[model samples]
Target: MSADFAGETARLYARFRRDLPSDQAAELAAQLGLTADDLLLDLGCGTGQLTAPLLPHCAGAVAVDPEPGMLTGLRDRGLPGVVAVLGADTDLPQLGRVLPPLGALVVGNALHWTDEASALAAGAALLRPGGGLAVVTQGPPLWLGGAPWQQAVRAVLEQFLGPVTATCGSDAAALADRVGLLEAQGLTVRVSSWRADHPVDAAWVLGHLGSALPGDALTSGGLRQALEDELDRQTGPLVEQVLTTAVVARRT
Candidate 1:
């Protein structure tokens, strides 16, 4: 299945969606054996959150995503050694022919939206003999089971949206499934994880929720009011724990 973001949703994603922490990016680079000479491929590089940080570690980068708005945001950054492309994982074969063989391929928090096996195969085909593939995922959303305020936020979402499944594959079951799939592809898999706390205010929370949910769901229904009421009751800035997990594999 393909997902596209535009208009207000794209705006909210560009503004509020957090980037992979610099330190975490470094650790992931080390795991992938990334170097200054290797070309990096950031698949589904939404607004360049995961693309920007990984640029310095590699020789250059080609960031690709299907959404035009996301590509626009990446292009706006004008990052050196980075080129944003409008395409999906399935387009990588053609990309490989024009561009040099990639040293690394990264699917950051966007693998769940595509057919995993097909995407992974396409990515592996683009990588050089010993190149690596890193799937960077921020474990289950902060609002799902983290803090009191976030738990309250989850309740509000469920109340309006019914049972909610996170768009990003953040849960333990999903992680296990991903690892199994990668292993099945004849690639060696290794995982690294760490937790981070991000300061969040009402606006950040609202923008984050808006990016994930449809506009009408929040505005037309009573969901928006309920969400606002919950946020208003909170005492101070919510310190949310962002758990990041990186699954690294080699094309060997």
Candidate 2:
């Protein structure tokens, strides 16, 4: 999340990536018993995607990221009472020392990049009793869903971008391990999931892909034009089915 979302790449991420649905956030807030007296810690909070939506449920937020650009974008958001920190999951214990007790901890499409056990334990330690940690997989990787449009996009990506196999840690196996980590901390586990479809054209698809691409690869060669043209040709009126999941674990 840090290296990938730096400088203009960070802006690309902010533009293409979306916040979680507000209704879902509200339900989660209610389930977690979040109140205005509470504070949230958004771990690996790239561009504050999780923070922005969930912040309204709480009094304030502490958004932490390892990338400076990410902090910059988050700060630009001007979220009231937000304290943007330049740090990673490993820095959580140190953070725990200074911040107030946490009401909820959220990792949105990000735990895959961290040392799962350590980060979760650190986050758990920061939470007050009855508070929770919600880990969200904002849907699968852009190039790796099972829909026709998804497969078509993968084909286009493979033709130009090599094999498109990264799951951003949302694969079934990764998710199972995440659940185990949550349970290992002795928290009660429950999940909320749904499927929805969105309409998109080739440029939308291309920009989403660009957001995930590292550094100048999007600007590198003939990749951009080639992808858009080929994608438009082989693809139909595009509809992508997003399978979203939220693993909410609450401390007793």
Candidate 2 accuracy as TM-score: 0.94
RMSD of each: 1.8, 1.8
- The stretch of ten residues in a row with the least summed lDDT in candidate 2 is 1-10
lDDT of each: 0.84, 0.82
**Would you list the clashing residue pairs of candidate 2?**
none
lDDT of 1: 0.84
Q: What is the total number of backbone clashes in candidate 1?
A: 0
TM-score of each: 0.94, 0.94
Error of 2 at 58 (Å): 0.7
lDDT of 2 by residue, 135-223 (tens): 88977786787867677667866876688787787778878888889899999888777666777777787777777888777668777
lDDT of 1 at 100: 84
Model 1 pairs in collision: none
Candidate 1: residue 50 Cα off by (Å): 0.8
